[model samples]
Target: MCGKGVNGFMKRIYMDHAATTPTDNEVVKAMEPYFTQKYGNPNSIHSFGQEARDAVEEARKKVAHLIGANPSEIIFTGGGTESDNFAIKGIAWANQKKGNHIITSKIEHHAVLHSCQFLEKHGFRVTYLPVDKYGLIDPDNVKKAITDQTILVTIMHANNEIGAIEPIKEIGKVVKEAGIYFHTDSVQTVGHIPIDVNDLGVDMLSMSGHKLYGPNGVGVLYLRKGTRIDSLIGGGSQEKNRRAGTENVAGIVGMGKAAELAEKRLVQGEEDKLIKLRDRLIKEITEKVDHVLLNGHPKKRLPGNVNLCFEFIEGESMLLNLDMEGVAASSGSACTSGSLEPSHVLLAIGLPPEIAHGSLRLTLGKDNTEEEVECVIDILPKIIEKLRALSPFKGSWEGLKK
Candidate 1:
């Protein structure tokens, strides 16, 4: 992780694991043969194709195993966004006869949000449920949102921006009792946490490979058996006629290997280790800085997520300063980067526009170390102090008042 910084060459600390991870060496090796030696279309009928087909099925099983789903129920897609679209639109269209109503939350990823918006234009009704100050969607809200014409309810297992873990299982129970289909965008939680589709009581779930140190071009949709969903793509009978496309052999193999490694790491207590780092970052930032607020549920959030809103200083300025010092992070959801507007997730969680503009998300990974955490803790305060001094609103800073 060494890099050329503003001062000199230094260690580059990555704190944007939620955006994507550095693909594991093992995953790269597993995918190497497929790009050349085992190059074959899984849809082909020849021996080369059969070999690829076998690898694809094996990868599907690995992905399913990670989430306690059946291999037969797994549907390979281009990425998380595609899986989300397939789930939301597929169910809405396929079961339109049953109802035209759908339910989701205000703090969902763009993939889910855009999908629901698209459905709303095409005669489908969608209810965007609100979250609490901590960004947790109330299960009772989901229960109350159901109508006679409700068809599906889509929510995320964990928020990508704030890392607030939602009550999917409880919401799942509510949807099930109403006989409405339920789907979850588990892209942020899938590889990082233990998940069981049956336990969550979800009819469908979406995940991306890159979030788990796998290849970037692959993802999966766990479509439980007997779920009514229409196919989005229609060219070949691939993916069991659910998602039609030739499988991404190399990427799929990489994702499968990554899934196995993620499962092993989770069972070996890697999550607890991340929690310690996350807490240290939060604790030090709060104690050493003024007018800063933690952005998510302190205990119910992800093990590796630390979102902080530092008043008076802008997030982009802080990110630029951190990058110059060889520390990498994000102001908000990576997908929404480059936008001048404040983060929608922060706003949804009740932060004012000025405070939301100051939010920063630091997501940890297995590769991060305590030394790195300590370095960040030391460097960040200096960066904040420098930025705050330059800020026009510095006179109003809580530290100045204190």
Candidate 2:
């Protein structure tokens, strides 16, 4: 039983790990000392400053180790959004002499899509490639999209909304054969899955701390050695002049600890446990519920992602009911939560607007237990039945069926 609601009858179960995760206790402990005891400017020339600088460098090594990259390749930034902006804009600006074209999938997070859109508004040309019904981008499509003018290929390693893991290695090989720079917005897959820059054949990768149970404002942009990219900011010579401004020392420390823990957990078989819970949740829900459509690739998905669209009911109404029952979930990305529009990812994958509007995403986490999954599975069907009973759309659909 997670947390009790106001009525004390329902337990608050958080199933929105994809949106953001609670900071691990060890991460908080790692960050606490940096906040007060080691509070010194890493750039300053003093003993205190050197201590902070050493901490930052150590954190960088940890982050690099997690991704199987050199410490020099990791550039700390404000967060995933900034890292994405840096990768897209930096590559474009620095490689204008090579080309002015970028390639990306239509179902990427807004960080990637909006960054590409921003470049499109400028002189650069961006090809928004289409995804299959499972939100998987074909490597053949990527090979076809390439041209002499294509400077960079930025695709996400995993889909945040639908949990479709892209064939990045295959795409990377295609891009590599063409001698084009490749980047991946791996904010969702960094800690959840094993990633090696060399194995993926990616030149740059973006990652967020919060997505992996670390501090919110810390992130890493893995820029491979000799990858030509301009700085997103212009001030101090931080992050090897790739990203400017004073570093978030405490946040970086927390992120490093989080990365270490994540790697350890993966080695100890955390993925298997999460996958079991995720599959159980999906199985129970689909078996008990009717008119439900599963999203994303069946097997090639994140370990804990369960995206489903219930017919004849609005997702927001379902979410509200779930919240009352003490279950926290998301219809889509938290970045686009307030928008009335259906999820772009769902729409891209061929879901009609009505079905897209009914999408529900339940992402499990490390702390989630089988009991929580059972509770959600037990109560969710009742909630859906209640919503369908009250929905005029469902009533009309039933009449049509009769």
Candidate 3:
């Protein structure tokens, strides 16, 4: 059993790792000194400041190592949203004379999607590519969408809601062959999957620290050498003048430690463990629940992701039921949870509105155990049954059975 909270509530089992992870103790420890003892602005000329600056550079190197990027290429930002904005808007603004068009999928995180929308409002044209039933954007569609005016193609490496891994390498190949910049919002993929910037042929990638067991308020944007991008924030010279702001020293340090730890775990076969647990959870749930469909690609998905849609129930109800039982998960992206609309990602993948409304995402993580998986499996079916009993679509399932 986990430790009780200050309110004497038993700790809930967290299955929402994709939404955001708790900062690892190791990463917190690595950042503690920066808060007080080593607290100095990296921009200052004093030795105290130089010590902080050195720590920031070391963190940058660690982040670069995890993604096979050079340290100089990594620009630290506020978080994934800021990184996405910088990658899209920064590139779009800098290259506006060359082209005023961009390409992206309908299933991207709000950060990228909203940035593209903002660009469209600014007189730039954007093509929102449609994904297939598996939430995959075809390379052929991407090829056809590229026009002379197309400056960039921004797609996410992984769908935050459905756990669908896009064919980024193939998409990158298309963009590279067309001589256009390819930017991927890799917030969900960076620490969870094997990512090498060169191997993927991506010109830019966005990553968030909180998504990978690091501190929030820190993110990294990997801009391939020679990529042209304007600075988002104009202030003190930091992040090579590409992202101008005072350095987030402690958050950057935590992110670097998190990246290093994730890299080491990847080498130690962490994927295999997560995959096994993920598969087991899916198998048990599917076996116990009727009229349920697994979303996303069966094989080509994140190792820790398991998204499903159960017939005849609303996702919010299921979530509330699960939460009452001390299990924590999410119906869709954490950013969009308060909205009444069904997940845009689920809709993009061709799920009917009713089915999309019933979606649930359960992402496993390093700290998750088999016992937790078993507990979820045991409790989930009962929750589903109760929800279905109260659902208006209950008749639909029965009618389908007949």
lDDT of 2 by residue, 1-402 (tens): 434645667667999999999999999998998888989999999988988999999999999999999999999999999999999999999999999999999998899889999999989999999999999999999999999999999999999989999999999999999999999999999999998999999999999999999999999999999999999999999888888899999999999999999999999988999999989988889999989999998889999999999988888888888888789998953233777678889999998777787889999999999889998998899989998887777533545342
lDDT of 1 by residue, 1-402 (tens): 334445655769999999999999999999999999999998889999999999999999999999999999999898999999999999999999999999999999999999999999999999999999999999999999999999999999999989999999999999999999999999999878889999999999999999999999888999999999999888888988997777899999998999999999999989999999999999998999988899989998998999998988788888998999889999863233766667778889888777787888999999999988988898899999999888878647444432
Write down the RMSD of candidate 1 (Cα, Å).
2.8
Q: Which is better, 2 or 3, measured by TM-score?
A: 2
Candidate 1 backbone clash number: 0
lDDT against the true structure, each candidate: 0.91, 0.91, 0.90
Error of 3 at 163 (Å): 0.8
Task: Return the TM-score for candidate 3, rounded to 2 decimals.
Answer: 0.95
Order the candidates by lDDT, highest first — what do you get?
2, 1, 3
Model 1: lDDT equals 0.91
Measured with C-alpha atoms, the lDDT of residue 323 in candidate 1 is 91
Query: Which residue pairs of candidate 2 clash?
Result: none
For model 3, what is the error of residue 197's alpha carbon versus the real structure, in angstroms, after optimal superposition? 0.1
TM-score of every model versus the real structure: 0.96, 0.96, 0.95
Candidate 2 lDDT score at position 129: 97
Off by over 4 Å in 1: 1-8, 333-336, 395-402
lDDT by residue for model 3 (183-225), tens: 9999999988889999999999999999999999999999999
